[model samples]
Target: MPTPLAETLTQLRIGNQKFLIDFYQRSRHLFARWAQRKHQLPPDKAHGLLQDTLLDFYDHVADGRITRMPEDLRAYLYGMAQERIAAHVPAHQPLPAAEASRRQRLLAQFNQLSTDCQQVLTYFYFRGYHFEKMGGKMGFPNATVARRQKSVCLRKLYDLVRGGYEPITGEVV
Candidate 1:
C-alpha cells in the first residue's frame, strides 16, 4: 500500500501502483474480519479476493468508464470483494483458445492502422475523449467526420481479422 496516505483513485487511474497497494492495505484487514464472520474461508482466499477487487477497480478507471469514486475506498473495496469471494473462483478467468486467438488477431490488425487512426482510437477509447475534441485536435472538419473515419478504420481492421483480405480499399501497397 502507498505509505503517503493521500492515495486516491485518481492516482490509480494515472497508472500508480502505489495507490493500488494503498487501497489493498486499507481494506484488506477489514475485509478479512468480515469474511471470517460470513465465510469459512482461508486467509489466503480472502487476500486473493481483496487483490482481485483492487484490480477490477483499476480496470474501471483505466477503461474511461469510472466517472465517480465511492466516498470510502475501504467500504467500496469490501463490497466488491464480497461479490468476488462468493464466486469461489477468480473474477476473470483466462479466455478460451478461440477467444484468445481472435483477440490476438484483432489487436494485430488494430496495430496496423495509420498513426492518426491509432491516436484517435486511443484518445476516445482509453482516455475517454469526446469526438468533438478528438476531431478538433486531429483537424477533422467536425465530429461526424471523425466518427466516420473511426468507423472506416474499424471496418478495415475487422476485414483483416476476418480474412486475409486486401488492404483497406484494395490499394496496392
Candidate 2:
C-alpha cells in the first residue's frame, strides 16, 4: 500500500544499514557542495550539517512524522538543512559569556555522570540514535530498556544541574 519511495524510507527507518549507507553516499557530496555554495558554510560545517539533516530525516520517518515521501527528496533535505543552518549560530560567532559559562558548568556536571549514563546520553543526543539502535549499540535487551535508561540518565543530569550539585566535591550547595 506504500509507494516505492515510502517503502525505501521505511527500510531506512527499520535498520537497513546498507540502504542507509547507500542513501548517505548518494547525497553526501551533493549536499555538502550545495550547502557550502548556497549557505557559505565551510566544508566541514556543510558536511556536518548534511549528517545532522539525514539523522533528522531518519528520526522523522521512524516516528511517523513524515507520513508522505516528498516528490523531491534532495529538495526536502536541502530545505531541512537550510532551516538548521538558520537556527544555529555560525561557528565563527562567539557564544555570549554567560551562555558559555553555563555550558561549561553543564558539561562539568555531565562529566560527573556514570559511564553508562554518559554513553547513553551521548548516543541519544549527540549521535542522534533511535532507541532501538541505541539498545543494540549499548547491548541492552530491548529498546524499551534503552529508553528507560536514557530517561533516568537525563533526570539525574537535570537534578544535578537544578540542585546546584558541585561536581568536584560531589555535594549539593
Candidate 3:
C-alpha cells in the first residue's frame, strides 16, 4: 500500500540505527544535508518532506526488517518511523471528560498523603526507581522497610480515594 520512495526512506532509517549514539553526532548533520539535497527544498519544507518520506518507507518495511534488526538499531528505527508518522498526524488532545474527572480525583487523593509518603511514592512509581534503589537513597537499610512504607501509604491513598467512610459501622453511605 506504500509508494516505493516511502519504502526506501524506511530502509535508510532502519540502516542508520546501527553504531553508537555518540557516533550519530556527525551522522545527524550528514542526514540533514542529504535530506536537504535530496528534497531540494528549504529547511521547513525539507523537514516536512522527510517526515512523509520516512512514513512511506516504514509502512512497507516494518514487518520485514523488525525481527532481524539489532536491539538498539531496532529501537532507533522504530522511534524514527514513529516520529515521522506522528509529525503529520494531529496529536490526541487532552483526556476525555470521565478520564479527566478520574485523574483529578486521583491527584487530590495523592496530595492528601503525608510529605514523606508522597516522596516515596513519587520516587518509586513516577520516577521508576526500584524499591531497593529508593530504600538506599532514602536511608532505609533494605527493601523490606521501603515495601512496608509503600504499603501503608497505598492503604491511606485507598481510604482517600473511597471518600468519607463510616468511622464505627465501616459502611459506604
Candidate 4:
C-alpha cells in the first residue's frame, strides 16, 4: 500500500541498517560534491555538513516530523543541507565597533580558560563534534562526561564574559 519513498521512510524510522547503509552510500558523494560546488565549502566541511544533514534527516523521520513522502527525496535532503550550511556559516560583513570590542573581550576571557575547557569548547563548537566524538578525543569515559564537561566549561566562559570574576585578580569585577 505504501509508495517507495514511504517504504524508505518507514525503514529509516524502524532502524533498518541495510537501508540506511544503502541510503548513505547512494547519497554521500553526490551530496558532498553538491555542497562543495554550490556553497564553496571545503571538502572536509562539506563532509561534516553531510554527516550532520543525514543525522537531521534521520531524526526528522524517527520523530514523525517528516511523515509524508517528499516529491523528491534528494531535493528534500539538499534543502535541509542548505539550511544547515546557512545556519553555521556567518556572513562576511565586518562587525560594528562595539560588537568587535565585545568579541575581543570574549576572546581575551576565552584565552584565560583552562586548556581542557578551551579544547572541549573548540572541538564541540568550531569543529561540530558531538559529545561522543569529543569524549573519545578528550579521553572522557563517556559522552555524558564529555557533555557535562562542556556544560561546565561553557558556564565558566559565560561567567567570565559576564564579569562575574576579575580576569587578573579572580575577584568579582
Candidate 5:
C-alpha cells in the first residue's frame, strides 16, 4: 500500500489544495528547525526559504519532476530547504582594506543625504520594510510613490559615492 505521503503526493501533483496545506503543516516545523539549526540562515531568511521551498516543491511536482514519492517526505523537505538556503546565502568573508575604505566613504555620504532619503533607504534596504507599509509610514500617497522615491534616493546615493561633487566647492552637485 502507498504511504500517506505517497498518496498525498499523487494528489499534490494535480494541484490539490488540501494536500498542499497538509504538506505545509507537516513540514513546517522540520523546515524551521533544520533551516536554522543546521544551515544557520537568519530567522527572517529561513522563514522566507520555508515559503519559497514549498512553492518550488509544488512547481517541481506540477511539472512532472517528482515522478515517485520519496521514501521519506520530511527528509525530502529538509533537503529542499537546504538547497534553497544554499542557493541564496552569500559566502561570508572579511572586507578587504580598499573595500572597507569605500564602504566608510559611502556610509559618510549616505549619512549626508537628506533625512527623507536616509529614512526611505534605511526602511527599504536595511530594515526590509515593504513599499506599501513604508509609504504609509513615510506619509507618501502610495507604494508607487515610495518606490520612485527609493529609486531616486538610490541613484543620488550611488552618484554621491561615485564622486559626484562640485570640483572646487566640494558640495554635492
Candidate 6:
C-alpha cells in the first residue's frame, strides 16, 4: 500500500489525467481540497500556493498534459506536471500594439453591456458553465432561456464591437 502522501499524489495525478480527457468538467476533488485549504489561509500560505499550482494543473488537463502518467514515478510525474503547467500558464510578457489595441476595443464593447447581461455572459463563457446550470443560477427555467439570453447578449456585444466604441474617452471608435 502507498503512504498517505503517495495516495494524495496519486489522486492529484488521476485528476490531472481526467482533466486532460475533458476540460469542461470541474474537478470536485481538487475543489474540495481547495475549500478546505481556503479556511486555513493567512497561516496556510503554502496551501494557497499549492491551490494555485493545482489550478494551473487544471489548465494543463485542457492542454492534454496529464495522460498516462504513472504515479509510481513520483519525481518524474510531478516534474512533467510542473513543466506542462508552466508552458500552459500565460507568461508575464508584453502584448504587441495591435493585440493591445484589439483587447482595448473588446473591453470597451464589453463595458457597454448591462451589468446583468455581462455577468451572465461571463459565467456562460469565461467560467465555462453549461446552459442548464447557468440558467438555473440566473433564475431561468432551462437552458433554452439561457441560450436565448446569451444570443441576445452576444448580438448586442457584436453590435457594440461593430459600432467601434472607444475606451477612456467613451467615444465612438
Q: Whose TM-score is greatest here?
A: 1
Q: Rate the local accuracy (lDDT) of all candidates.
A: 0.66, 0.72, 0.53, 0.71, 0.67, 0.53
Which portions of model 5 miss their true places by more than 4 Å?
Answer: 1-6, 89-173
Clashing pairs in 2: none
RMSD of each: 7.0, 10.9, 14.1, 14.6, 16.2, 13.6
Candidate 6 global Cα RMSD:
13.6
Tell me the TM-score of each prediction against the true structure: 0.53, 0.47, 0.44, 0.45, 0.43, 0.44
Q: Which lDDT value does model 6 have at 7?
A: 32
Clashing pairs in 5: none
Cα lDDT tens digits, model 4, 39-148, are 88777777677666767777677557877667877788789889977787442334478955864677678777777887787677645589999999999999999999
Candidate 4 backbone collisions, by pair = none
Off by over 4 Å in 6: 1-93, 164-173
lDDT, candidate 1, 143-162, per-residue tens: 99878877776666666777
Worst 10 residues of 6 by lDDT: 164-173
Q: What TM-score does structure 5 among the candidates reach?
A: 0.43
Work out candidate 5's RMSD over C-alphas: 16.2
Question: Model 4, which residues run further than 4 Å from truth?
Answer: 1-3, 89-173
lDDT of 6: 0.53
Locate the minimum summed-lDDT window of 10 residues in model 3. 164-173
Worst lDDT run of 10 residues, candidate 5, spans 164-173
lDDT of 5 by residue, 1-173 (tens): 53465446545543455765766777666666766788776766665676666666776765567766677766786787777556764433334789557646765677667778877876776445899998998999999999998998888888887788522222222
Local lDDT at 121 for model 3: 70
